[model samples]
Target: MVKVATTPLDRTRVARAALKLLNETGLEGLSLRAIAKELDVKAPALYWHFKDKQALLDEMATEMLRRMNEELAADEQPDTEWPDALSAALRGLRRHLLMYRDGAKVYSGTRFTDMSYAAPMEAHLRMLTGGGFTPGAAARAWLTGYSYTIGYVIEEQSMGPDPVKEEGGYDLAARAERLAAYPLAAAAGDEMFRDYDAGFEKGLAAVVAGIGATMRDAPGA
Candidate 1:
């Protein structure tokens, strides 16, 4: 093995190196050994920055979310409506995760390194609450939208290969033949996987609309 001088690693450097490995080998192949190799350090050196692989993964998730928020902020319009801003934020998150192999796998269910995420959280809460949602409804609305985006992307990435390729969609026609006896099930074949982007947008609109509708007549509005 080539022995390169170690540049003194920190949490940011370690998380970045792990993400590089994740893009190349994905989560299944990701390990402290691989990250150490990428960083040109002994595997044990990583333990200084992270207790274990899961800690490193949580940092990666946190970093990914940070970048997502930054990207969204760059393009945010001052006059954008709350619902539009909220939906766009979710879309930005999904786009950011699709950049890596098993990217959503790295994010979902993983913890963040700190509560500095309060900036984005506060922004989202302000949007919902300002739109007439009660405090509880605002929190739930933000959670529901963000959760839907992340959950959908997790499955989207877990599919056979990258969704950016031609192999992204399901063969509803093939499924229809398999479920010939079940009419509704067969009918759903087309709608279920025809267009994920369109589906996500439609679902996000529904969630935002529901939140807006329910909260409109409640205490806030």
Candidate 2:
């Protein structure tokens, strides 16, 4: 694909260009100068739009959140049960993060610079609270799930082509053999490095179920 020689630089343009730079050079190699070159603009000119690399990164993060909010807004089923709603929301987040190169790292490392960016978060809080969860419980419920998904994706992206195992990564067979003294945990050797999708779903369900239980058992519940 032919990249545009130069962009009519703006926050959105700069941020998108930086994401392109990220695709070419990872987070370690990404720099303001690199993005500036991608935009066909001078390094100093980039400062006129973004104060620094961090400022550009904040916009990139905002871009991810923007996509997430758009996804949530189009759901048409926001009032669904908290578990389903939470699952959909979290999955949407993961999908958006997985869109760009090193997306999870870019998203997790930068904070939202837009005040309006909190819409989905607020909406989730309301859903939980309406579902019999106390205000605090609602906040914790969403945050716990959100944190887990982001953390999982970050680790997934960091693994490069080999997500579950490196050359010297976890040796399930060796550990299982060594742990033969305890047959139960030892039996989980292959299970440990099995499909991440299945494992993540299980953990997410547990979190959602725990929230429901927590609300049910709450003082006035």
Best by TM-score: 1
Q: List the residue pairs that clash in candidate 2.
A: none
Residue 107, model 1: Cα distance from true site in angstroms: 1.2
lDDT (tens digit, per residue) of candidate 2 on 158-218: 6434322333345677888899999989987556455656866887788778767765334
Looking at model 1, report the run of 10 residues with the lowest lDDT sum: 159-168
Residue pairs whose backbone atoms clash in candidate 1:
none
Candidate 2 segments whose C-alpha is farther than 4 A from its true place: 1-7, 160-189, 215-221
Give stretches of model 1 more than 4 Å off.
1-6, 163-174, 216-221
- When superposed on Cα atoms, how far off is each prediction in RMSD? 3.1, 4.7
Clash numbers, per candidate: 0, 0
